[model samples]
Target: MSDTKDSDSDSGTGRCAGCMESTSEKFRGFLNFLWNPEEKTVLGRGGKSWGRILIFYLFYYAFLAALFAVSITIVLGTLDPNEPRFQTRLQAPGLSIQPKLDASIKRTSDVIFTAGQADTYTQYTNTLTEFLKPYKENQATLNNCTNGKVKINQQYSMEKPPPSCRFDLADLGPCRNEPYGYDVGRPCIFVKVNRIIKWYPVGFTDLSKAVGNADSNAPPLKDVLMARNRAYDPNRMYVSCYDVTSGNQTYLNTAAGVSANTMYYPEDNGIPFKYFPYYGAFLQKDYMTPLVAVQFNKVTRNVDVRVRCKAYALNIQDNERMRIGYFTFTLRVNE
Candidate 1:
């Protein structure tokens, strides 16, 4: 009985050892098949099959990369670096003003400041100072085009660049002063016509008659032309600013009374014809946009006065919402 039990135990131990060895051998075979299989295969794929797949994918990706590069090159080749491909919005250039309020202040074209406080008005003066810096520097080097005649450059070239007219900073007169009138109640707002490539303004031959027939929103031509020591020119693009606090009625709010006391730098209240037909920044590197500084001499203190400035020309359109040739801003001078 003892011998029989011992033999049975020995037989059972031998069977268990054989089972473990079979499992180990199977695991080794699976690992070998994953790395390098028999019949010269790797991961169940023959060497030729693996090479074929790699070559196929390499050529496919290479073709896709080449196609993408060619598409980009073709698109870029057709575009001109100097000129914009589309200029739909530039048909009638808009108008912009400087000494604008800081972006942090959420105001819609409002210049609000205390006359006596430096912090309130310093930002305004600083803005004007920086904006006029380039004009001051490049004044001497620019071409002095004839005042009444338009400067036209039909053809542009690398050798002979387009002509750029000199916009002398001194011409800004009182507005060019260090304080810029912000210290006092008076404030000088610089108005500039938006630059449109190769677009020149065609001035009204007959100023009085043109104003009479112009859009209802047009600035009063009679009041604009009657500026003190006025320098009126029929061939130049004119700018006029008037208080519109009470509906469409245009007048300057003054201590004396409602009158046209607003003043423009250059005495003419107009931009000379010589500065028109801007040849873009690329062709005319040092080109300066002509400015008309509108000075509000006495704009009733502590009141939000609505003011609208318009640029008059035959080609320019009067669209307040679109800001084609006019811009409206609020001015408030605090004590």
Candidate 2:
């Protein structure tokens, strides 16, 4: 009876231990099969399974690549190369002031200059040259354009061949001189109206009378005194410049000494009406914005003069942020 009891206890203990070891072996075998691809059997599958997986991933990646290419093609088809598709938010384009930088300053919205600084003045003048590069006139492009106004009434005409008004850069006159009037403390401020399709100025009629009626506190529009000689156009836009700081009595006395004169290129008052209804780049590839150069003649050395230029139009609107129809900059000719 004792021998039988001892035998039974040994058997019970040994069986439990043996079962545990078997389970551990099975688990280790499963891990080796998953971890080692070099092993004959893997994930309970034949060698063909490995080849199948590689083929599956190759097809999957190729399909994803093809889908991406198609998506890009669709997006490009919707875009217009010449004009923006959506312009409702920016109904009126802003006025651009050029030469608004120096060599040290890569880009800026305001201008800073020093009298007798030829290097700084030259740098600014070069910028103007580059800006006008697109508008570089040649015989081929000017075939349809003439000295007078050219208008396009049909979309098909724009498609067939559009017309552009001749804007001879020579009209810049004294402002376009070497050093650009910087040597004599007279810096040229180039103003351009941003391009917007089918937009026309409303308050351009009798610009001389309108300029004459400028704010009494501001300096007189002495430039308009010569308007009597030139033929004024009702369809063109008008520009006005004033000393915004003239409101202060102390500043006004000092500001009066600086002669600020407005000189419009191609014509006086504003950009010509002939350059209107800007078609897309496809129609007018060499199109450029109508520009006005205001020469601040006799700016006092070492004085900080703040000036503002505004475009007047009955239909055109103005914004407080200087984003549309207006811009302000400081002109300091420090020696």
Candidate 3:
């Protein structure tokens, strides 16, 4: 009896052990990652690492894209500042530049009067008087120093300059017709005439000097800028362009549409230009050089700029006074 009871107890213990082993095996399947030595300690393939890699690639691609964008923007800016297309030519009247500049080469000596030369004195004096001899007594009104009649913006170029006096009188009247050749009217009529003649409301006084010059000996076709002057006021500033080169006067045919004797030349590279060639009459608004078939798109880029034109004096040059020369000035767009 004792032996049989012992055997039964042993069998019960074995069954209990088997049940515990089966339960451990099932739990091991659920927690299998806990004992994997290589996976637990290795340094890679985590979610954080993948996020960082993705972010690095995004920034790297963005930087390259920005660099390329800047490079393209710089290269694409080579378009002409002055559009030279024929259809768009008549858009801006001020931009309507002709082939060559036109203005009479006048000398200051032609207007100055000498005491001994009565004929010459009378001729200029008559011209002076004719300019001043207005039919009306309102001469002082036009002088800005006095009554200041016309507004500043109202001024424009006409075929003829504004009248010095009313009713185009032929003569200043001999007055004393005196041997001294002194001017008539009140005190300093000649001085006022001289002032008006020198005060050009339409022409440029100075020329520009540019930067990054391609050549040091050539005057390139550039957008002419206003040079410098002491008496120039920003609000009431006037402009004018003078011939820098002392070349012979060129007479262009506006009718036939070509220029001769002028220094401006077109590029032979057959590069299609965007600007039209324009020319005006010597002293008038006449189309001496009509909107020509030339171009100015590649003017500044191709041409080398070296020379900045100096202010040409149009009066006598004795005793350091430079006033006896012809400076036909016309203002072109600076900007």
Best by lDDT: 1
In model 1, where do residues sit more than 4 Å from their true spots?
1-51, 101-109, 208-216, 227-232, 248-252, 255-258
TM-score of 3: 0.20
The lDDT of each candidate is 0.78, 0.63, 0.28
RMSD of 1: 7.2
> Can you give the TM-score per candidate against the true fold?
0.79, 0.70, 0.20
lDDT of 2: 0.63
Two-way lDDT contest, 1 vs 2, winner: 1
Sort the predicted structures by TM-score, highest score first.
1, 2, 3
Ten residues in sequence with the least summed lDDT for candidate 2: 212-221
Predicted candidate 3 versus true structure: per-residue lDDT over 1-335, tens digit per residue: 99999999999999999999999998875565444455542234455766888999999999999999999888667643223224332221221111121233243321232224454345444444443334224433432222212223333244443323221111222221232123221111111111221122222233242211221122211221211212322122111222222221111111111122111111111101111122122222221111111111111111122211112122211121222111222211111
**For residues 42-66, could you state the per-residue lDDT of candidate 1 as single tens digits?**
7888889999999999999999999
Report the error of model 1 at residue 189, Å. 0.9
Maximum-TM-score candidate: 1
